[model samples]
Target chain A: MFLLTPVLVALVSILMVWIFKNSDGGTERRKGEARAQAEACPWVDEDLKDCTDVHQVEEDANGWQESEEDVEHIPFSHTRYPEREMVRRSQEYYELLSKRRSVRFISNEQVPMEVIDNVIKAAGTAPSGAHTEPWTFVVVKDPDTKHQIREIIEEEEEINYLKRMGPRWVTDLRKFRTNWIKEYLDTAPVLILVFKQVHGFAANGKKKIHYYNEISVSIACGILLAALQNAGLVTVTTTPLNCGSRLRVLLGRPANEKLLMLLPVGYPSEDATVPDLTRKPLDQIMLFYFLKTS
Target chain B: MFLLTPVLVALVSILMVWIFKNSDGGTERRKGEARAQAEACPWVDEDLKDCTDVHQVEEDANGWQESEEDVEHIPFSHTRYPEREMVRRSQEYYELLSKRRSVRFISNEQVPMEVIDNVIKAAGTAPSGAHTEPWTFVVVKDPDTKHQIREIIEEEEEINYLKRMGPRWVTDLRKFRTNWIKEYLDTAPVLILVFKQVHGFAANGKKKIHYYNEISVSIACGILLAALQNAGLVTVTTTPLNCGSRLRVLLGRPANEKLLMLLPVGYPSEDATVPDLTRKPLDQIMLFYFLKTS
Candidate 1:
């Protein structure tokens, strides 16, 4: 479903582009009339009759694109492309998504797979650096894979929980009541694995450089969050395993990429609970006048 | 408008609570029923039943509140709140807002004050840590204030543009064709300042630590963007200011707060032009698994 929507949008957008492109057939004629009038009279004439012959002259006598359609393009030579309506629409979609909250302890009911596909597709449209588009999403759905992933995660979590591989910083997570064990990861219907491809494939089997990998990955994740929420699914964004190397080996990830987070996605249980969190006031989070640059 | 909505929700919620509380006054009847049953039960035959003196039992029964209303009190006993249909309906209003964009140039119009108030109120509801909700938004609609801001930014921009702020980094920013010169400061009708409060004022008159300041501020800004856009306004997110101390001194900000970005909000000019920048493709930004944590 996710794949289909982008294709549909792409198809529709392409059609719209063709329609808009063909509509601008009158821009050239106006320019031609202006040029003919200028050539007919080098000086401002006392009589308006100085421009009489120019009205019938060929627009675009200079002949940039000398074709039958050129005659119809003279009036709109100054037309710029319309503003990107799709991008503006995307921003609005994300704004409504801002209301989505993470839910834990989900109910037994299964979330439709189509919903997940649509959400991932929305994430796929996020812009990246150099158009390299070097990201892959591995959706974990089967219970066995989730269990295996949990096992791999738990081994590292045990070490972290035991405080062998961590410092005082580990204790800080307790404020949010996070634990070494992540049960929701196993329980949630899906775990989205976000991987950044460090380089592109080359003919010689070598790697090509990728630019802005971190920023590109982050923006994509941001879009994914928005998409999932937009689709009415809740997600819990779990971050890098503080214990590090354990997760990579357990997840069987290639050396070229690292684990950023295992985002658990599903509906919240009727009894699901969240920390009673409050946000900072609006005044503190937005800047209005001080740092403006045109 | 925002203040009123939450206040009204709370007020109505409290009124419901009062109704529920007042009805609890006669709930003592169930106890009488249980006691009467205990007296009538035949345990050790007559001796057990002997306690059923009619007048005493009647007096005791009258003393206890009736339990017949228990069926009617079913909803009160098990708490369930109203459906958030209105909040969900609010999304449609935001969906219309999805048409707004981040324009580079803005028209100089005298922005109405009421519009600004609604946007700010919309911005205030963003979620935060421990409900700490740590953000502030300062909206500057004054023309003279904008000029002062532009002057200060120009001082920093001139230095950065000249390769004085590290040649390699400055050169990269130039690739985007961005410069320190800020014309939007003067061109926009409104300016919004986003700040994250690292600490909060405690009930004990002391500074309290705030958690997740970055995420908190980012969320609020996201809402602000939506609100402004919903109101048919465009905004540009600018963060060229080094802004730590320089802005603190300039804006009379407290030391605990830091600047994030300056947003110029208004309608786009009829003949505005923007850099022909293209967004990178989506695949490059979203990783299927964690780059480090998966």
Candidate 2:
């Protein structure tokens, strides 16, 4: 549905190109207006701009055909850090991340919409499998929608905690003491619902399978959390098991889309508290093998 | 398997506490030495250290038992950023990430082992599902292992390109010009095989179910990629769809672990190039609903 507009626009340009190629064209006065419109609407196809100028249509088509013929590549560019700076940055980032906690008590204090936008944009930069970019972010700040989502989650969580989860699972969660109730869902000013698109419809309306949709969405969500943390916002990753369909219905997302996680984004409340948990040390989490030494 | 060591240490400390409580046998000198040793090893439990200090053991146990009485909570801490700095950092990070590309041609230039270590450490900080953190990263630098992995991946990729993937998939991949050949696997100096542990063995040998294992691991992998990129290293995510079992066998990981992705890490070759692709514009990926406006 998202790409349909672009695809339709491209098709219209293709038709325009066909007409310009065959017709005894309009005056230069009309052509100038078309060029101005094309320049203004940057979203329009470049070929359409050339189509308006009949003299350049053939040349543009030739260039397009050539590009279609050979695969193109661009030089990779990156910023290199000095050794000390790299180390310092790594240390600082590690320290910053170490302080991050899975906060549940989120303040209803209003977060600027721009903060949420930038975080989502940062998330969009994540590399996806096959560059499918098969994910969508839905930011819901409406009271009613958040209420609906909270209701759907609590209901499923009730079953999950009471019956679906095994005794060991329940015991494991004893320290966290999380229950069926999810007040934070309605408490946070913004709820970012991450949706994973399993497949997409192509320009030709054919079904295009997305490779590693689960992994791609997870990666994006991870980046989202980090971005939010970097912005000094707080969140906890909450997955409502057995509520995917309910969430889809409420969010008005398509059948192919699945709710990956619901993040309640905001500031930590004045009395907010989290489990005093310690991360596994590097010795436990990592094993290094230097080739020179090994 | 991972937490067993900590649990064992805790058990030994519990025994020591029992002994100290039953008979006040140890002299002040011996007690002082034990307390000093515990202080030296801060990663060892604070409870264990308190146990060594007789006067504090009762108080600590009372605190611990009550924490065990109900769920415990600690204050969440974060560093706040000034407005300008926040904007600048976000823009810089976005720009840095924007330059990141899935480089295929890698130079086997020697990257300091410390760099890889720090990058992985950054990735390890990603929040996990229910705090499970169920992931194991296997860094394979041995030439023989890399060669074996390359072989396994290419074999499956060949089959994938030739048979398994639909025509639409192949057509979609046409622009990337990627085929079954994956020489970068061998050309790169290091390969990190990320494994997702579906469940873990607890200290008591009971099976512990990890929630959203796929999502948790994916998030870590994503952060790993970004961390590597931030460190000026290049990598491409390669998932060998059918070779998880083989990889598990090769890597000596247990049955519970599933190989998620294999990333070949190194500097991009001087002549390396990537497809010039634009990310989907922000408007397409994000929908914002501000409470005040809505």
Candidate 3:
């Protein structure tokens, strides 16, 4: 009976250890399941998951930059307009931009490459975080490559619409008339794929952090849109859901680059239509703080 | 001593449970410590921590949107430019924008409020994800309020530079000649504080998810910058670290609105200077995919 007691104790210890290990294993298994679900779902928010955060954690002691060399400061020239000219100029610019719309129905007519180059140059003039300029513009004109991109995006979007997205999202989007099918991918004469460099290498080959890279890149995109409008081109801004990795690999972008936006640039087709939408007025969007009653 | 065996068995079981509970508690304690450290650090990356993420997780079953009514589609009328005109317009636009520099030294000369209204109106034309237009432009003209903003920003920035940031970040910013002291915030005639609406209230008072709200607001800021430049104004884009919540509260912005970027808008001082920086060339930043030999 004494021997039996010892054996019982041993068995109980083994059972307790097994239960604890199994419970822990179950938690890990559920995490894996959730990740799998996230991957398959449509709204995969991989927009700003830059490698800088990982490197920052791993190399926390190294700080963010390696360059200690300072640049010289030069006097900034000014172009001050008369108050009346400023008002007139600002008003004219607003009228020009207000006419801009996101046109999805694009004609397959070829556009001047020089115009594209100039607009991109204007976009490059955007102010970046720490002046990193962590952006890449890939202009794809090959018909076959564009077709392949369309296929990949459409396939992923189909899964998103049919299997992942709930009825509410789908219903909300019915107004804009967007769906899994992307005819613009195949129809637009040119596709500008915008990639944000999550991190850049310093001259010494150490990682340089691109601070606020996503916001900087999007700002550049805003300028690109304005330039395109100025040049009389039409495009629809798109952030293809769950297609960044595949498109990155397809475009042969480096590991440091991730897709931020895709603009299919061309002229609008004859039958092109847009949802009749109106923007918030000046009072609704702009707040003048503590104004004097002068 | 007759019940000694049973007592010992019970003691062993109790000890095992205690060990398990203690180990789990250790993990939680470690996590809490890491979070506390993150809160104290200057590079607190609260840029895109929107409430939509939380709502999406909690209300995963309901989907993202609640509106089902559709808007009418209208024919898109576009102005097609001649190839020569397109090239000329694109080139002129690029040249005008390329002259823009992030000028920090601002004169206290008051800008026309009418121009400010026009610039903000132009920014409102930016394309947003799902057409949410989730942005608010707060123009602070009151000198006292601007001074208050300067105080809040400098207080946080002083902490960022002196206590939290490593020497590396300070070194990186040395070339730009930027420090915690922001005289421009008070000197500039206008302070435009850009805020991103993380979420909006639905017509039914339910939470409405503003998809890609950060990117949308950044894009709008981009257009705002361009409009300012077109109006011959000088401003610098500043994303003051760890000062968002305080500035938001100071501006009386709602909880749903998070500060994205702050631009102090006015004419550059006569002796205002800029760092001698150069942007990447077009060939370096742009890629032409598989050009045809025709």
As a TM-score, model 3 comes out at 0.90
Among all windows of 10 consecutive residues in model 1 chain B, the one with the lowest summed lDDT is B69-78
TM-score, second chain, candidate 2: 0.74
Residue B5's lDDT within candidate 2 is: 46
Error of 3 at B109 (Å): 0.6
What DockQ does each prediction reach against the true complex? Answer: 0.05, 0.16, 0.58
Considering only chain A, what is the TM-score of each predicted structure?
0.62, 0.75, 0.87
Q: Any residue pairs clashing in model 3, and if so which?
A: none
Query: What are the RMSD figures for all models against the true structure?
Result: 35.0, 26.8, 3.8
TM-score of chain B of 3: 0.87
TM-score of each candidate structure, all chains considered together: 0.55, 0.73, 0.90
Overlapping backbone residue pairs in candidate 3 total 0
Q: Per-residue alpha-carbon lDDT of model 1 for A139-203, expressed as tens digits? A: 77767667777776677667555643233223334445566677776778888876666544445
Residue-level lDDT tens digits of model 3 in A1-294: 233366666766886786677557645755765565453333545544543555354446554445577799999988889999999999999999999999989999999999999999999999998888999999999999999899999998897778666665677678899998899999999999999998788876677767678889999999999999999999999988778889888888888898989999999999999999999888989997883456
Order the candidates by TM-score, highest first: 3, 2, 1
Error of 1 at A161 (Å): 5.4
Instruction: Show model 2 residue runs off by greater than 4 Å.
Output: A1-71, A288-294, B1-71, B289-294
